[model samples]
Target: MDTCALFHRYWALASESGYGDDLSGQIRRSHGRRPQHGSTANVYHGTFIPNGLEVAIKTFPSTLSGMGDGSEVLAGLKCIFREVHIWSKLRHENIVPMLGMSKDFECTISVISAWMPMGNAYDYVQNTNNDPRPLLRDIASGLGYLHGHELGPVVHGDLKGLNVLVSSDRRALLTDFGLASMNTSTFNMTVEAIRGGSYQWMAPELLDNCVATTESDVWAFGMTALELFTRAVPFPDCHSVANVVGSLILGRLPPRPTQESTQFRLTSTWWEICTSCWRRDPSRRPTVDEIAERVGRAMYDTAPASFTASSHAYAPTMDTMQSRLSFTGDGPRSAPITDNDNLLPCATLSGLADKILSLSFSPDGTQIASGSANGLICHWDVHRRAQVGPLSRGHQHWVRSVAFSPNGQWIASASYDGTVRTWDVHNGVQIGSSLQGHQGKVFSVAISPTGGGIASGSADKTIGLWDVQAGKQVCALVGHTDKVQSVSASQSRIFVSGSHDKTVRLWDARAREPVGRPFEGHTGMVWSVVFSPDGRQVVSSSQDGCLCVWDVRNSSRVRHRLEGHTDEVTSVAFSPCGRRLVSGSMDSNVFVWDAQSGARVGASLRGNAGWVRCVAFSPDDGRQIISGTEGGSICIWNERIH
Candidate 1:
C-alpha cells in the first residue's frame, strides 16, 4: 500500500488495539525541542488531553541520510515495515517503551510511556539551580541500567541535553536510541549523525568521525552535566554556529565551571566525575555503570542498582564494565538554547495490572478474582489495588463467570466456546476443565457446595455434571426447551437452571435426574440465577421483569414476584452479610434488596451511561461499589447507602 493508505491502515489498527491512547501519551512530555531543523527524526510531546496520559511521537523525515532528495521515492513501503521490525525487538525501562508503531516510519511512529513530571535535568538546573548534582546521580543510574544490562549494550548515540528525558521522581531516562548503530561512520559517526542532537553538548569525538564508544558517551555526559548545572552552553557567548566552530578550532573548550557557594555544593567529588569525563583520552573516563555504583554507594547504603534491577537486567554486570573514550572526534558547531529554564512538564498515568476485559470479585468478600479476556484469571492485591496473577487458562474463550469454591481456593469460569474451567486461585494455574459435550455456548456455570465438580448450563438446552479434573461429561440433565440462560448450585447437591423454557428447574447434580419439581413462573427467557448465601433460598431473574426467590427444600416460591427492573437483570449476587442482595440489570442500574423482606434498600446507582457489565464490592471496603461499564470505564463509588 502507498504511504497515505498505510497511515490510515495503522490508525485503524491503533484505535482497535487501544494502544495509542495508553502508550503514546507517555512519550510526549519527556521530549524536548527538536535538536535540528529538517532532521530526519523529529521529537514532539503528546499529551493525552482526555485520558490524562502523556507520550512522545518521533517522526522520521522523508529523506534519510540526505541520500539526495531524489532518492526519497526509492524508500519503499517495505522499508517502513522493516523499521517496525527493528523497533519491535527493542524493550527496556531506562529506554522508552514502544507502544504501537504506525505502518510507515516516515509518517509518525508514536510510543506511549510513563511521564517524568519532574522535568528534564537541563530544565531543573536552570530553573532550580546551576549545579544539578542530585539530578546527575539520577542520570547515571539510568544509563547504568541501559549499558550494563545484558539486554545488549545499547549505546545511545544522541546523548546530549535535549534527549536526556527526566522523570518526575528525578530519575533520568536516556532516550532516542533509534539513532544508534554498531559503531561505524556509516552507522553513527558521520556528519549526518548530527541529525537529532544538541551539538554544543556533543563530545568532540561525535563530530570528528570517531566511533561513538562508551568513552565518547562519557565525554558527552560531562558536557551535559555542565549544562545541567550552569544553564549555560558548553561554550558560552559564541553567538552563532560559525563563531562556536571558529573558537573550537582555534583551541577553545567551553570554560570549565568554577566552584560556587550554593545550597547544593559542587565539591571535588562532583568535579572528579565531570572533569574525568572530558579527558582528552577516550580510555580515561568511567562507564555509566561504574559511575552509578560509586555514586550510589555514597548516597543509598546498598547500590540503588539492586532496586532498579527490575528496570534492566544488566545491573549485575555494571560492576566490571570497561570502556575507552575519545575527545577529538569533532563536528560542526551548533547554536545554543535560547530558553534555559523553561519546562512544559510531562503528564503521568498509573500503570495498569493487565489489559483488563471482564473482572469479578469472589462472593465470600475475603478474596477477589478477575477473569481476563485473554483466557486467564487474576486475583487482586487487596493492599495495592493492582492485580496479582496466579493466572490460569482452561477455557477456549474469554471467561464469563468466576465463582470462588465454598472454601475460596478454586474458581470456575463459563466460556462462550463451551467449556467450564476451574482454577487454583493461589497459584494461577488451571486445576481442571469441565468439558461437557455441549452443542453450543456454555452460558452459565456454578460449582457445587461440596467442591467436587461443577454444573454448566449451555445454549444446547442441556446442563451437565462435569468431572472437575478429567474434563468430561459425567451426567447430562436435559429438560429445557431452549437455551439454558443461568445456573445456581447449592450445598444440598441441588442445581437450578433458568432458561427460555420460561422456568427454573431443580436437578440433582449427582443423581442424574431432575429433582422433585420444575417451578414455572417467568413469561420470558430467564437471564440470571443465584443461590442465596444461606443455601436455602434461590433468586432467579428473567427477561420478564420478575425475580423469584424460591424456598429450595420445599420447591415453593417464597417470593414469586420481586419487581422493578425495566430490562433483563444480567447479574445477581448476595452481599457477604447474606441479608442483602445486589443485582445488576441491562437498565444501567444496580439495586440492593433486603433478602428477608424482599424490599429494595439503596436507591439505584444511575450514573452509568451504558449497561453495567460488572458490579463488585471491595473486599477491604464493602461499602465502596466498583462498576465496570460497556464503554470501557471502571468507576469506584465510595458512597454508603441503606
Candidate 2:
C-alpha cells in the first residue's frame, strides 16, 4: 500500500481497535515517521510510526506478508516472539535489545531499539575493504560472552553479515538472533524441531549430528569469523550451501586457504583457535573465555591494534548519511543529547572524582536531586545550575540506591551498609534513623504512591515496608528464595518484588497476602522492576537483559518482552507521563524508551563514568532526569540539550 493508504488503514484499524483513541499522541507528531535502515526484515521503513523514538518504528504491512498467510503470520510471530525471548537473555555491548512488544495485524512487531547510524557490518563490507577487526573483536567478545560467559552458551544459530550492525565509528554488533539458541538449552532442542540457521555458515555436524553441540557451534563461528574478514557468504557463489548438506555428513572437509601476512598472517595461533573451534570433535573446541584469554594475551603482547573497524569496516565511502539529531562526534556516540550543537552546560553539578549515579526531580522542579555512592546526595537548583543544598551525607558506603517520596519531602537511600536511611529532602539532614532489620546489603528502594510508606529491597531476599510518617518498620514481606534485587509499588494494592531466585512476587500491602500468583517466565535473576502509568502494567528487568511488562490487574507478563541494554538493568523509572521509561545499568549508560512505542527516545544517556546505579524521574517534571553513578557523582540532565 502507498504511504497515504497505509496511514488510512492504520487509522481505520486503530480506530476499530480503540487504540486510536488511546494513541499516546505523544507520538502523534511522529506520525508517518519511518526509520532510516538497511536491509533485514523486508518492510517499508517509511510506513511505520515512531514509538516515541527516532531510530526505530513499526512498519505498516504494505505487503511483504499476506492475510491468508495465517500460518506464516503465526510462524513469523512465533519466530519474532522467540527472538524477543532469546535476545533478552543475551545482553552485551555488541548486542541491541528487543523488549516487550505491541503488535497489530496492520503492523509488524514493535521495533524497540536505539539508533545505529553506520548501518550493519554488511554495509561496511560492501563499502570498504578495511579490516573488520574491532567489530570482529566486539563480535567475538559478544559471541564469546554468549558461548562462555556467566549466563552464556548462547548460540547465534544464524550468524551472517546481515545480522551484524555497524556503528558510525565502525563498531560492529550482532543482531537478529531469532534463530539463536542458548547453549544451556541446545541439548533440549532437536534439529528436526527447528533447523534454524543460515545455510552458508552451518557447521558440518548440524547436518550430520543433527544436534547442537559445542563443535557444531564452533564450526559455525569459525566460518562466521572468516566471513567477517572476507565479507563473503556461501550463497550465490556456492549455489545455496544447503546443497552441501550431504557432503557435510560424509565428513568431507572444506578447504580454507590461509592468507599469510604479518598483517593477514593466518598463523598457528589463529588456526589453532579456528581449527579447534571447527574441529569435527566438539571436545577440541576452545570456549569463548579460552579464546579471550589467548587473543587478549596476544593483543597485550603485540602492539595496540588500531580501530581496524574504521580502516576496513567504516571507510568514509557512504553515499548517504541521514540522522535526525546531527551528531558532533566523528563516530556515533551513545548519548544523542551530546550533540555539540545541542550541548547543555556542564554547570549542573561538577567537581567530583566520579560519575553520576541517581537523578531525581523534586516535585516543584526547583531542585534536582542526585545521589552517588561517593557517599553524597547532591541537590542542584534548576535555574542556577548550581548546588542548592549541602551535600547530603551519612551512608559511608556507596549509596547503592535512592528514591524520592511522592510528596517530595523525603529521600530514601539504600546503602552498602545493609541499611535504609531517610534524609530530609529540603534540609539534606539525616532523618536521624535507619531501617536495620535486613542482614544483607540493601539493593533497591521505592516510595509508595499513596505517600504513606516506603519499600526497601535487600540482598537478603526480603522487602521491608516502612511507615514514612511514623518512621518505623511496618512489615517484612518475604518469599523470594534468593537475593531480592528489585521492588516497586503498584499503587497501594500491589507491591512487586523480583529476586535472584528467578521469580517475581506480587503482594497486597493491605491484605498482607500474595496476590493472584507469582508472575514467572525469566530464567535469570530479575534486576529492575517498575509500575506502568495506569498501575495495571508492571515492567521487570532481568539479568537476561529482558524487561517483561506484566499486567498487574490480571497477573500475567505482557506478551511483549523488552530487550536491549546489553547489561543487567539495575534501575528503571517510568516517565512522568508514564508513556516513557528510563533504565540504568552496569553498562554505564541510561536508555530512555517510549513505553508503548518501544523506541529509545534519545541516544543511550551517557556521561556516567561508572556503572549507573539508579535512575528516577522528577515527580512532576518530565524533562528533569537524574542519574546516580557508582563513582559517587550525581548528574542532573534537563531535557533541554544545548
Q: Go through the candidates in order and give the C-alpha RMSD of each one to the true structure.
A: 19.4, 18.5
TM-score of every candidate: 0.43, 0.45
Q: 1-642, model 1: which lDDT tens digit per residue?
A: 244555455455435644333343223233455422324455455654444345455555652333433234234222333333333445543455555543233444444344454445566555432225445665675566556544465456667666666642233666555455332221211123222345665566556655566676777777777677667667777788777666645546766566552223444565566777777667768878777655533321111111111122111111111111112234111122122111001000111111123445655554456553335565654333433443465566646566677677777887776777777777777764456588877777777767777888887889978876577778778888777878878667778888867788888776778986777777767877777656777887766766777887776555646798776666666655567666666565666677888887656654322444455554433555555433223334444332
Worst 10 residues of 1 by lDDT: 340-349
Which runs of model 1 end up more than 4 angstroms from their true locations? 1-360, 372-376, 390-394, 432-436, 553-560, 607-609, 614-628, 632-642
Off by over 4 Å in 2: 1-352, 597-602, 608-611, 630-642
Clashes of 1: 31
Mind sharing the TM-score for model 2? 0.45
The 10-residue segment of model 2 with minimum total lDDT is 316-325
